[model samples]
Target: MSRKKTTRHKAIIDQLSVNPSMRVSELSDALGVTTETIRRDLEELAAQQLINRTYGGALLRQPAEPVLSERHKANVEERAMIGKAAAPLLKGARILMMGSGATTVQVAKRIAFEMNNITVVTHSFGVATALSLNPTIEVVLAPGVYHAGEGAVHGAQTLRFLSDYSVDWAILGASGISPAGPTDALMDAAEVYACMLRQSSRHMIVADHSKFDRMATARFSQWQDIDVLVTDIAPQGPLGQALASGGVDIQLAG
Candidate 1:
């Protein structure tokens, strides 16, 4: 297929995935293509078993599982900056709750050395293990079904355990973000993060700048849900304005 045809097909797939039953005219308007062209792309996607043809447009097929580890390595510096920005918030925290992510792991290391009287609650093996030997800090692991690839505990048991106590602060990471909200690449992770958010008083999101423009499979929280957004650089333009308007505090790390 030609480049134009491929682009049209991808657009149709994205739209159908988001809105399973769109009219051809709606798809055309959204993609800036003629209705006939939308129909052609729908037919092509249906032929590839990518979608199910409806009366007008198409229904989305199930998407493939995303590779989480490869994505973690994509922006190392930004994550480090986010870690540095988030560290200061942990200074006075007595009970800290952290979620699983490379950035959160960095934050864990930063707090391990400086913070005392700290009781760390986490679903991440990385965080738990990192602070395991810190005599000044106490580490509490939330028990649940562990996924090796993600190296985090998740499921009903974890959520149940987390609900039993509230924390002073919760630090989290997102797979992506836009003006609407922050999202996760995995549904299971999103569920666990939601539980963490509810069990903490101060909700802090530690996401790198790259997460700002992307989209993901499962949305966990809106920008408003976050009390503070600790990122490497300040987000500019409409996204930044939207976050600010939503009362999300922003912090930039060098």
Candidate 2:
């Protein structure tokens, strides 16, 4: 496709994400394109099963599973900053429960290199192995159904296993964060994180600024459930204001 067509395709997808359904005339006006051009884009997207074709434009398709490796590559510096800031909070904690994600992986790296004499209970195979590199930290693996792509485990077994232990803190990562609270793309993973939140004394969410104001398919916990939020930047706009008043303390890593 041409550069213009590629850009138009992305714009169409973005608009459809927010509105779900749109008309060709509306899309053309918004994108500053001719109606025929809009129609061609819609047709192409529909052919790819990225959208459901309607009379005029199209309806949004369900979002695909976000790849873990791709997520790990995105916002690298921001996640590292957030990780460094959050790792220090573990200084006095004896036991911790952590969820799996790129940000959390950064936290694990910090813990492995800096923190010591802490016990980590996690469903992430990668996290457990990472923490195990530090002889001072005791790593406990939660057994459950494995999600190979995510390098984590989630299901009834994981929840039941976590119930056997109480932790000083729960460090979680999210796909999206808003006034409504933290959300994840995967349902089973969300369930495991929800269990961790309930089983810990304090819940701290670690996410980058990009996650703010976004909505994910599955909401795992409410804003009130969060004790602290560690991120790369201070949130701005209405979502930021709402989060500030929503009771969770926000900490900027930058």
> lDDT of model 1 at residue 139?
91
How many clashes does each candidate structure show, in the order listed?
A: 0, 0
Residue 232 in candidate 2, Cα distance off native in Å: 0.9
Error of 1 at 164 (Å): 0.3
| Model 2 lDDT per residue over 37-152, tens place | 88888989988878756566665654554677788889999989998998887779999999999889888988899898889999987788778889999999989898988999
Positional deviation of residue 245's Cα in model 1 after best superposition, in angstroms? 1.8
Q: After superposition, how far is residue 212 of candidate 2 from its true place, in Å?
A: 1.5
Which regions of candidate 1 deviate over 4 angstroms? 1-72
At residue 197, candidate 1 shows an lDDT of 90
Instruction: Return the TM-score for each candidate structure.
Output: 0.76, 0.76
Whole-structure CA lDDT of model 2? 0.84
